[model samples]
Target chain A: MTTELSLVADIGGTNTRLALSAAGVVLHDTVRRFQNEGRQLNDILDEYLAECCPDTKPHSACFALAGPISGDTGRMTNLAWTIHAPEIATRTSANRCILINDLQAQGYALPALAPDQLTPVLSAERDIRAPRLVVGLGTGYNAAFVLPIESGVLVPAAEAGHASLPAHTADGRKVVDWLLANLGQAQVEDALSGTGFAHIHAALHGEKATPPALLARCEDGEAKALKTLEVAIELLGGVVGDLALIFLPRGGIYLTGGFGQALTPWLRQPHLQTVFHDAFAAKGKISAIMQDFALSVIGDDFAALEGCALRVAQN
Target chain B: MTTELSLVADIGGTNTRLALSAAGVVLHDTVRRFQNEGRQLNDILDEYLAECCPDTKPHSACFALAGPISGDTGRMTNLAWTIHAPEIATRTSANRCILINDLQAQGYALPALAPDQLTPVLSAERDIRAPRLVVGLGTGYNAAFVLPIESGVLVPAAEAGHASLPAHTADGRKVVDWLLANLGQAQVEDALSGTGFAHIHAALHGEKATPPALLARCEDGEAKALKTLEVAIELLGGVVGDLALIFLPRGGIYLTGGFGQALTPWLRQPHLQTVFHDAFAAKGKISAIMQDFALSVIGDDFAALEGCALRVAQN
Candidate 1:
C-alpha cells in the first residue's frame, strides 16, 4: 500500500517536479525537476527513480498534471504528453498510480500546508471544515474549490478564470469594455494573469510591455505602471471576492500561481483587501459571509507534489 | 429512528407547507399549507399536526427553512419567526428533528424528481455523479450546488444570487450599468426575479408594470413587453452560464422557483439556449463544458418538503 515510500510528481506544461515521500510528507532532499523537452512522463519517472531511489523502487506513484484527467488517462491542455495512470504503474512496476488535475492537487495540499508555507492576506477565523478555494493566476488562470466531506474532501473542478471578468468601477468597466471589443471576451484570465499585465499596461498607457518589465517599471515609481498594477490587483480582488461569495470558502482563499506568488507583498497590502471587501459588500449577507474568509497565498512551490503524495497515501 | 413515519415542512417567509411522509416519500393527501401572518413556525406546525395527524404523533420531523440554520435555531430572513429543531422535537414528541436551508432541501430533492417533474431546457449528457446546480429565480433569487459524495450528498450553503451579474454583450453591459447605477449593484436577483420584470419593463418602455401584467403583454405580442422579457431571459441565461462555468455542474442546472417555472416555455426556446451558450463560448474549455451540461427547470413545488423528508430518513 506504499505505506513507507511513494513517488509523487507535479507535471506542468514546461516542467515536471518530482519527489519521494512517506505518508504524504515529501522528503525535501529527494525533490527533482525535469523539463519536458519532447520526453514522455514514463521516461521522466524512470530517470527520477534511478537518481533518487537506487536501492529500492517506490511502492506506488501519484501524479498531478496541468490538464484534465478522465478515467485512467490525462491530456495536457498546453503540452503534448498524454498520461495514463495504469500504464505509468505498469511501466514503473508500482502497485498503484493515480492522476489528478494540478488545481485539485493544490486543493488537496491545502490541509497539509505549514504556517511558513502560507502568507495570510485576509486574516480571520479559519474553519477547516468549510470549503477552500484555490485561484491560480499564472500564464493562464483557473480555480478549484475543495470541499471537506465525511469520507474525504471533494475538490470540484472549476474553470472560474475562463468566466468573464466583472467590472467593479468606472475605470474597470472601461478597461473591460475595451478588452471585450479587442479580445472578443473579457475573461477573468484577461485581467488576472501574467499575460494580463500586458493588457493592463496597454490599457493604462497606450503601449504593451512584458510583465517583468512592467513590474520593474513600477518598482522604479513609474506612474503608469503603478496604475496598471493597482488596476490588476483591483481586478484580482473583485474576482476573488466573487468567488468567496459564490463558494463561501470560510476555510480560506488561496492564491497559487507564479504571478500570484510574485505579488504576495501587494496582495497582503490593505488596498487589495479594501477592494475585495467593497466588492462583496455591495450585497449585505454576502458581504458578511465574505468578510469572514481567510485569504492567503501559497509560498511553497511544491504544493502540488505534496498533494499528489497525499492522494497516493489516501489510496 | 422514525423508520415508518415522519413529518416534513417547508417554511418560507409568507407561508409554511407541511406534510406527512414515510421513508422520505411524501404523502400528498396529508400536505397542508398555512399562512405565516403573525405566528411562529411552532404555532403553524402545531396547527398543522392537530389538523392532519390528530390520530397519532409523527416519530421524527425535518423542516426546510427560508433562512440560515445555525446550531439548533433558525431565524427567518424576512419573517419574524425563529425556529429551534430541538424545541420542535420536544413540542412534537418526535425522536429526531433536523433543520436545513430551503435551497439545500431543494438541492436534496434533485435526485428524487421524476422525469415529468423536470423540463429539459438544454439537453446534454447527465452525469449523476457530477455536481448539480439549483438556481431559484422566484420572489428572491439564489442558487445551491448539490454535490454527489460517497456517503450521501453535500449541498454547501450558497447565496449566489447576491453575487454580481456579468455582462456578455454590449446591450447586456448597458442594462447592467443602468441596474448598477439604480440598485447599487447588478445582482443576479435584480435582473432574474419577479421584481426584475418591473425594472426591465421600465428600461424598455418608460413605465413600470407588474410581472404578471408584463407576461400577459408579452403573450399578446406587445413589442416593448416582449423586449423586456427578452432582456430578462438573456440576463438569466448569462447568470446560469456563468454558474455553469464556475461550478461545472454536469449533473444539471435546475431552474426552480415560481418565476422560473412560469418562464419554462420561454426558457426552453432556442433564444435562451443560444444566449447561454454564447455567454460561455467566450472561453474554449468552459464553452465545451457548458455545452455538455444538462439544463432543466424543476416542476415540483413540494420538492423542499420531499427533501426535508429525505433528510429525516437519512438521519
Candidate 2:
C-alpha cells in the first residue's frame, strides 16, 4: 500500500509552521516555516505548495490557528489574517480541510506526545483515567482541560491567563501593585508570559531586561536576576496549583511553550514545590489531590504539529 | 401507562433530604428530612422508606452526597457515615443504584430547572450553544462546567473555591491577609461561602456574627455591615469574572444555594456590576463575552431530587 500524505500547520502570531503527515506521523523532511508578514493565508499556502511540494497534493489539511474559530472561519487575534477552511480546501485541491483553535490543538497533542519528548519536572504517580491539563505560557498564556467523555475525549479551552493575578507574599503584592500601575491591570498573563518576565525584571531592577538576559544573569550568579526568577517561578507554581484545584487533573499538568521550557530547570526548587502544595493544603483534601499530579514540560517543539496530524485522522 | 418512581436523596453534612420522583418531576409531598446523627446511610434509608413511602418500592435510587464518591462507596467528609450504594439498593429493594457528588447533582439540575426556579441576576443575552456554569455558595463552595459533548452534555466539577483568592484592591488584600493569618491560607471559599460570610463579618467587626444577622444589619443601614457586604460582593464578582474567562460560559453563570439567593437583591448594586465588568473589560473579547452571558440564581430546593430522577431515566 502507498502512503497518503496530509497537510498540517500550526499557525501562530509571528510564524506558521507547515508539515506533511502520513498515518498520523509528521514527515521530518517535509517541514517548512513561513513568516506571517501581513500576507493572506491563501497566499502563504500557494507559495508553500509551489516551492515545497511541487508535484504531490495532500488529500486533507488541518490548520491550527491562533484565534477564535466560529464555524468554518477564523480570524487571528494577533495577526492580520482571516482563514476559511472551505476556501483553503478548494484552493489546495484537498477533499477536506479543518480549522481548530491553537490551545485545542495543544490539548490534542498531549495523547500523541512520546515519553522522550517530555521531561518530568515534578515527578509523582499519575492516575491515567483522570483528566489532564495543558498550559501554554509563551508570548501569552492559556490552558486546556482534556476531558474523557462518552463518545470520545473533549478538550475545553481556557483563557485563564487573562484572568486576575494572585499575590501571596509581601514582595509578590508589590509586584502586583507595580503591574497594576504600569499595565493598568494585573492579569496572570501580565506576569507569567515572556514579556511578563521582562515586566517582572523591570519591576525589580527599575529597568527592563530581556527574558533570556535575565535567565543568563541568574545562571551567572547575579542576585537581582536570581531573585526575579525565584519570585516568577513561585508565582507560576502558585497559579498552576490553583488551576489544578479548579480542574482536579489527576492525570497531570503539562507545561508547554518556550517560557515553560525555560522554567524546567527551576521546577525542583523548594520554593516552587512549597508554594504549589501550600496553595492546596490551605483547603482540605486538595493537598492530597495535588500530591497525585505528575508535572512535566513538553520538550518537543513539534507536539502541536503532531496534534494537527491527529485532527486529520479524526476527520 | 403508570409512571414509575425512583427514590432520591440529597445528603448534606447535617441533613439527609429524601424524596420520591416520577418521570423527572419530584413529588414535593413525599419529601422527608432526616438528621444525620452519626448513623450509617443505610439506617437513614431504612427510616426514610418506613416513614415516607411504606407501600411503594422504587425501581432505582440515586444518592447525591456532599463528599467524594469512588466506584460503589462514599465517605462523607463532614460527617462520619460511610455510604455504599449497592447495599442501599439491596436494602431498599431497588434494582439499580448510583452515587453522584452534590455539586454534580446541582449541575444536572440546570436543564430541568424552570424559569420561576431561577431569578435573573444579570439580564444580558446568552449564547445557548456555549457552555454554562453552576456555582454553589452555601455551607461550602464549588462549581461545575456544563459542556455540550457529542453524545450529550458533560458537567465536569470544579473545586474552584479552594483555589487561591485574587485581590485587586487594598481592602480586598486586607481580607486576604486577615484570612491568611486566621486560616493559614486564603482560598476563595474562605471568603465566598456561608461560613466565609461570617469570617468576613468577624474580620471587619472584630467579632463574629451569624450570616442572617449580618445581612439584616446591612439592610437596616448599619455602616460596618454594609461595608463588609460591599467588599464580599466585589470579591465574588471578581472571582466569577475570572471563572468566566476560564470557561467562556456564554450560557452564563448560574449562582445557587441559600447564600447566592440572599445576594440576588444586591446583584443590581453598582459596586458588584462595576467590579465584575472591570475584571473582564481589562482584556479584549472577555468583556464582550461577559456581556453575552445571562447570569441567574437557581431558586429551586428540589433541583437535586429532580436531577436524580433524570439520571435514572438516562440509565
Candidate 3:
C-alpha cells in the first residue's frame, strides 16, 4: 500500500469538514470540523493542517462546496468564500487539486458506501449495473444521477430543486398554490428544503416555526406539526418518483443531506412510508415499474469526504 | 472507401421508414416510408427491401422503434410488433442487428443534423462539449438526455411524460386540474401530446375538438382555437424549461415528434415566441441560466433513420 496522503474537504454554509485519506479511503480518526465564523477558508485550512497532520503534507486534494462550480472555482452559496483550485493547491502544498459540487461528491460516494450506512426506505431487487441517484434535501434541495460507465461513474450536475413543484392531489396543489402566492414562485427547493419545512408549517398552520421547532412540536403530539411532516414527506415522494421515471435509477435512490437525515425516523414510520410510496407510485400507466427502484437514506455524514477522496484518486 | 451497405429503419405507429447508409451517412435517395395498413413488421420489411434495394444486401442493420427495448428485443407501443434483434438479423440477412428507442435515435441524430433540418426557436451559442436533450411531443411525451462521452454519446432513457404535469400560472393550473379530473392523473403527456391539444381545447372551451380541427380553426382566425394553441405552447415551454434546468442541456434542446413539428410555424411567430420564452425563462432565481440552452425544432422527418445509421456504424 502507498503511504501517500490526500486531503479532502466538504465545505457547507456554516461549517467545513477536513479529512485525510490514504489509498482513497478516508481516515475517520483524522477528520475535523470547523465553524465558518466569517473566517477565511485559507485560515481554516492552515489551522486544520497544523492541528490534524502536523508533519505531513498531502500529495493531492479535493474540495466539495455547497454551490455551483464553473471550471476550477467554486463559491459558497450562503457564505462569502470563493474557492479556487490553484489557491487550494498552494495552501495545501498539493500537486493536484480538484473542486466539485457537494451533490456530485455525494454521488461519487455511492458506490463506496457500506451496506450498514444505508437505512432502507424501500427495499427492492438492486440492479447493480443501472444508474443510481442521490437526492439532497438540506438547506437547499438538489439531486445528481450517478451513471456507471465502463471506466468508473459519471455524476452529472442538475438544478432540479429550482424546477417547479409538482402537485397531483388537492392538498399538494394547495401547498403549491401557497408557495406560488407567498414565494412568488413554486419551486422544489421552495417547499422541500429546511426553509421549506417552515414554509409548509406556515402554509398549513398559519404560523411560523423553525424545522427543529416543528420537530419538537411533533414530539409533543401536535397535530398540525404532524400534518406538516406528512405533507412534506408526500411531496418528497412525489418529486422523487418523478425523478425515478426520468433517470431510471434502478440501482437505488439514496436520500442524503442534513435535513434528509433528520427526517429518517419520520420517513421510516409505516404510515408516512405508505404516504410516500403512494404518491411516488401514482403514475397513470407506468406506475408498476416504480417498484423496481429501491429507496434508502444515507446515514453516513462523511460520505462527501469519501466522495472527494474517490475523485482525487480517480484523477 | 468500402461499398458495404447498412440498413436503418425508424418504426412508428402509423408508418415505417427504411433507408440505406454507407460509411455512416444516410442515403436520402434510398429512403422509403410505408404506411402500416395492418401489415406485419416482417412483411413490411420484406416488401421494403424488395422494392427499395433489391440488388444489395445490408451487412448490418439498426432499427429505432417507438417503444421500450429490453435487452435485444423491442416491443412497439402502438403496433403489434415485437422486434427481436436476432429475428431482425435473420430476416434482413444481416450479421448484426441492434434495437434502440425512438427518442434515443433522435438524440444520436443531433450531432449529424444539417442546419437546414432545424428551425431555431431560441438560438444561442452552442457548447459543443456539453450534453444535449431531445424532447418528444407526439402521441406521447418523453425526453432523452444526450451525454457526450469520449467514444460516443450516451442517451439515457426517460419517461418524463408520465410524470406529473407542472403548473405555475393560473391558466396552467386550470389545465392541470382538468387533466386530473378527466384522466384521473395529470401527466406531462396528458397536456403535451397530439391528444393533449384536444384536451387543452376542451379544457379551455368546454367543447370537443380534434387537434387537426383545432389547428384549422387557429389558421382560420378563431379566438378560442388561438387561445388553446397559445396555452399549449406555454405549457410546453414550462415543461421544457423544467427539463432544461434538470438536464442542463447546454448543447441545445431539440424538439422532435409529429405534433412538435406541426407547432413550428406558430412557435416561430413573434408574439407566441415571446409567450414561449416567457414561460421557459420564468424560473425565479436561476431563470438567467435558461438562456444558455438553445431551443430548435427538428424539421427533418427522417432524422431517426439517420440516427439508426449512425448507431449501426458505431457498432
In TM-score terms, which candidate is top?
3
TM-score of the first chain in candidate 3 relative to the native first chain: 0.97
- Give candidate 1's fnat, 2 decimals: 0.63
lDDT (Cα, tens digit) per residue for candidate 3, span B190-278:
99999999998888889999999999999998999999999999999999999998888889999999999999999999999999999
- lDDT per residue (tens digit) for residues B1-315 in model 1: 534789999998888999999977899999999988977777887888889888888999989988877668988887878898899999888888888889889998887899999898788988878889999877778889888876567788777777777776656776777786787677777778888777767765658799999889878989888788777877777677778878888888899988989888876668755655565454644466667778888999899998887777765
Per residue, candidate 1 scores C-alpha lDDT tens digits across A166-193 of 7858768767877877787788888889
Q: Could you arrange the candidates by DockQ from highest to lowest?
A: 3, 1, 2
* lDDT, candidate 2, A58-89, per-residue tens: 98998898777877898887888889999989
Q: What TM-scores does chain A show, candidate by candidate in order? A: 0.93, 0.91, 0.97
**Global lDDT of each model?**
0.81, 0.81, 0.90
* Ranking 2 against 3 by DockQ, winner: 3
Point out the worst 10-residue segment of candidate 2 chain B by lDDT: B277-286
| Residue pairs with clashing backbones, model 1 | none
For model 2, the chain A TM-score is 0.91
Model 3 / residue A134 / CA error / Å = 1.2
Badly placed stretches (over 4 Å) of model 3 are A1-4, A51-57, B1-5, B49-57
Which scores higher on TM-score, 2 or 3? 3
For candidate 2, the per-residue lDDT at A121 reads: 69
Q: Highest DockQ: give the candidate number.
A: 3
- Ranked by TM-score from best down, the candidates are 3, 1, 2
